[model samples]
Target chain A: MSIASILFAALFYLAAITLAGGLAYRIADYARTPAPLKIPTTPAPTTTGGVVFRMAREVFLFESLFKSNLWIWLFSILFHFGLALVLLRHLRYFTEPVWSWVVLLQPFGTYAAFPMVIGLAGLWARRFLVERIRYISTPSDHLMLALLLAIGLSGLSMKWLVHTDVVALKTFFLGLMRFDVEPLPASGLLYLHLGLVATLMLIFPFSKLLHAPGVFFSPSRNQVDNPREKRHLAPWAAEMEK
Target chain B: MAAEITAPAYRVIPIVPALKPDAMEGVKPFVASEKIQDALGFPGTLPDDWHERAIAKMGELLKKYRSLKVYLDACVHCGACTDKCHYFIGTQDPKNMPVARQDLLRSVYRRYFTLPGKLFPKLVGARDLTKEVLDEWYSYYHQCSECRRCSVFCPYGIDTAEITMAARDILDAVGYGQKYSNEIIGKVHTIGNNLGLPGPALENTMEGLEEDVKEDTGIDVRFPIDVQGAEVLLITPSADFFAEPHIDSLIGYAKVFHAAGVSWTLSSMSSEAANFGLFIGNYEQMRKVALRIRQAALDLGVKRIIVGECGHAWRVAYSFWNTLAGIGAGADDPYALMLQKQLDQRHKQPTHICEYTWDLIQRDALKFDKTKNDHLVITFHDSCNVARASRMGDEPGGQFDIPRNIIRAVANNFVDMDENTIREKTFCCGGGGGLLTDDLLDLRVKGALPRMEALQAVVDSHGVNYLAAICAICKTQFSKTLPYYGFNMRMIGGVHQLVSNAIILENKQ
Candidate 1:
């Protein structure tokens, strides 16, 4: 294996472990911490089944964002949906036979990068243009946008602008999965794209990106509006009664 | 109401105001006195190690409350909630924006807790919990009404109210508690209400109310106090016994009970339903304040506990009362189960007065002469807590509908304010979440600009003369701020006040 392959392989392992383990630890922390009060934003669903539907709508549709601002919602859905397709399409690199759906989704996923880049641009522009959004934006916020934009551009460049040996890249990724390092494509754009993706994975658990899993645990969104019917007592609060 | 503090002019289109950086700098609520702090079990004064203590308190809260932890972590600063805050829109202060306000604490939270913030503080907008930062937290967090309006629009459900509450809790933990909330909480602990009216004083107020009602309507409507074995226990805000328009709603509750023919009594032990502990965001203190209501229900042997018209009071009674004091059902705890068993299961435990009145109106049990309110074309102001934090009837969004229903039944001519200013999207009356104190008068008047603009629109288009509300704070806030906007202070009154004006007392007729 080449030094480039070995370095890339090690970095990917570290990134994957950090992403999964960090998310697990953070998610468990959120799950264990009790929501001492019933704080569902009202007009909320009362039943458990209703709460499930509400959360589904929130996650799948960004329902609150849609209700808030059409501009943010449009860009958010575009980037998120585009990223979803691209990630799913990339499954062809890992699977031995390249799943039938992944094979079929290749064309659509190639086009998805456009919307993904466009969405990120709109979101980043808001950070500079909108006074309220700009006031709240920190260096990390702007940098996060820059990083995502770079990843998207580099990935697109490799795909269309500067074509790399994709068959070798796929073999290198599949080898990494099986702990058998292989030679990587000699492409600067490919390395940059992979490196950025690794960085994003590493930071996912620590940054506001935790919002991905945090939404699932948000008491305001996840909780049922049945405080009158059922009592919710945290362990610490319950000790007060004892 | 201050001479120098000018109210913002009403907008023809109700546009969100432009950012005015530091527009409200140095605008902080009064610091709690040592005695008031001690009354709420906080330190008598700012401790020497306040910075460390505040950080410690934030860490403790992060572990205890999921809302605090998740909210602190989840905010993406999307600015969806930027134009959403009434204070931000009214004051034009970027710091009043929900995201900016939350960052006052989030910055410290990051510096102390998160890895990126510890490693690259400026990059992530994290800072040390310095005296300056704490002072900033104090100024901005109090400006928030804890209304949860921004939470409605957040993509991740990042509630600024939860963050503000957590920030206040940390502030109080380090002897930085606001005077208005801390003092009122102290009053609730000692005198059983925000007004600090003693039992005899409350009795006198009720007696005076009874005499006035009898003289006005030629009917003897008894405002019974501490009556044992009453079927219903009415726990209302002490403002009802003191403040104008609020007292009218107090009489309205009595009139509703008399018309419904229910045996109800007010308990001196828990005469107040407004829980300032909630305002201060101290869970233990909140629970302690709620426990009095439970004790009163048990002591008076009342089967039902119905709340009076107060915004945060109704929120606590409806949402937190069960968890805090066992005022609702399905509790595994013995005390909670005991209280639950004693409360009449047929009706909602600790119901809102509007809910009770609306149920009666629905059943045709109460008669209203709508013509009595013909002189007034009225609009309803959905109190922040009632609009976004609590429910009324069994149906969702019932809190908004129930009050309007009561108004429509009592008054023939009723028009709603702008749709955006009503229901779940309602703006706060500016003097809520313990900012109702006189010290915050300037912030209160200015923060009410959005609501005043919406009201002005209806007044111009629909000739709305009266602004009806269910929450005591809304009535009080609007009554004080209405005159500043070229309207009569008397134009604002409670939903129940309308019921009082038009309600037909069978005994009188």
Candidate 2:
């Protein structure tokens, strides 16, 4: 194994373990912390099925964001959906034989980069332009935006501007997924994209990126609006009741 | 800082301007007096170990409330909720922004709890739990009415109210709490209501209301008290006994009960529905206040408990009462089981008054003379608690419609304020979350600005003379601040007041 390949493999391993383990820990913490009250934001769906539907609209459509602001909704949804497609496209590299669905999604995912870049730019601009947004935004917020933009731009550049050895790149990612290590391709843009992606993964569980899993645990969203139907006593609260 | 606020004489919907950071910096409500704090089972003064105690309390709360921890984790500082708060809009205080307000505690949470915050505090906007930060928490958390306005807008449904509650709980744990909320919570504990209205005072007030209604409509409506074998126990706000428009609504309840021929009694023990413990965000305190209702129900032998028109009280009654006092079924706890066995199982145990009235109206059991309200052009102000926190009927959006339906049944001219300003997106009346005291008058006046603007909008196009709301706090807040906006204080009336005016007696109809 090349030195570069070994280093990259180790970095990927650390990031993967950290991301998965940290998420599990955070999720366990959330699950254990009891919601003593039924705090579903009202007009919230009452049943489990309805809650699923509400979450679907929230996660997929950014329904609440859509209600809040047209501009933030447009950029945020575009960015998230575009990121989804781009992430899906990258799944091809990790799979031994590219899945048929992934093969079919290649063209659409390639175009998704355009909106992803544009969306990140718009979101970034709002940080500096919109006064209230700018006020609430911290240096880390701007830095996070820049990091995402850099990742997207770097990925796009390697695809469109500077063609990389795809066969070598796939081997590298697949090797990272498997124990078999491969020689790392000496492409600057590919390295940039992979490095930034690794950075994002490493920070995912610790940073505000936890919002991805945090959304599901949000009592305001996930709680059933049936407080009047059943008593919702957390163990600690139930102890108090006694 | 001592009553320096010269409130604007004319209503001004503050133009969206550049974010002026720290606009509400010096703005803080007076602390709860030592006696008041002691009365509520809180410390009389800040303890020597307050820092440790406060941090410990935050850790304890972080473990207890999933909403608090989840909200703290979920906020990305995306600023989606920055401009969503009415106080932020009214005061132009960046800290009043829901996200900024959450950050007041989030920064501290990050420092003590999260790894990134410890390693790189400034990088993630994390700060240590210091005295200054505690002061900021005191000021800003009190400013938040816990209305859940920003929660509706948040993509992740990050409830800043949850954060605010946790912060207040932390503050209270450290012997620092606002006077208005603590005083009221203590009063409810001691005298059964925020007004400190004892059984005799309440009885006198009810007698006066009955006579007033008799004079107006010649209906001998009886406001019964602690009558055994009554079918319903009406848990209402004490303001309904002490305040105007609220008292009118109390009369409306009496008339409705009189018309429906339903036996209902008011318990002096749990006389109040407005639980100020909710304002302080102390679960034990909230639960203690709520338990009175269950005890009252058991003592008075009431099968059903119907809540009167109060915002946060309905939210508590509808949302937390089941958990706290066992109003709902399927509780493993013996206390819950005790109450559950007694409450009527066929209907919702604690029902909203609007739902009750609407149910009667739906059944065509109640008749209203709409022409009686012809002198008043009314608009509905959806109280933040009922709008966002609780539901009315079995169906969703019933909270919005039921009150309007009741109004439509009673009144001829009804116009909703700005569409964006009503329903689940309703703004607070600035007096909620226990900021209604004379000391917080400036904060209350400024915080009332967004709501004032919406009310003004309706007045301009629709000539809305009466701003009918279901909250005692809303009625009280608007009664004081509406005159500041050049509207008559009489404009702040309850939905039930309109119902009282137009409710046709069985003999007359």
Query: Highest lDDT, which number?
Result: 1
Span of ten consecutive residues with least summed lDDT in model 1 chain B:
B1-10
Q: Single out the weakest 10-residue window by summed lDDT for candidate 1 chain A.
A: A127-136
lDDT of 2 by residue, A67-158 (tens): 98889999887898899999999888889788999999999999999999899999999988888887778778988999999999998888
Off by over 4 Å in 2: B2-15, B330-333, B506-509
Candidate 1 Cα outliers beyond 4 Å, as residue runs: B1-3
Q: For residues B19-93, could you state the per-residue lDDT of candidate 1 as single tens digits?
A: 899988988888999998988889978889987788788889999999989999998887788889999988899
State candidate 1's TM-score.
Answer: 0.98
Q: Report lDDT (Cα) of residue B480, candidate 1.
A: 90
Per-prediction DockQ comes to: 0.88, 0.83
TM-score of each: 0.98, 0.97
Minimum summed lDDT over a 10-residue window in model 2 chain B is located at B6-15
True-structure lDDT of candidate 2: 0.87
Q: What is the C-alpha lDDT profile of model 1 across A74-136, one tens digit per residue?
A: 999989998999999899999989999899999999899999999999999999988778889
Clashes by residue pair, model 1: none
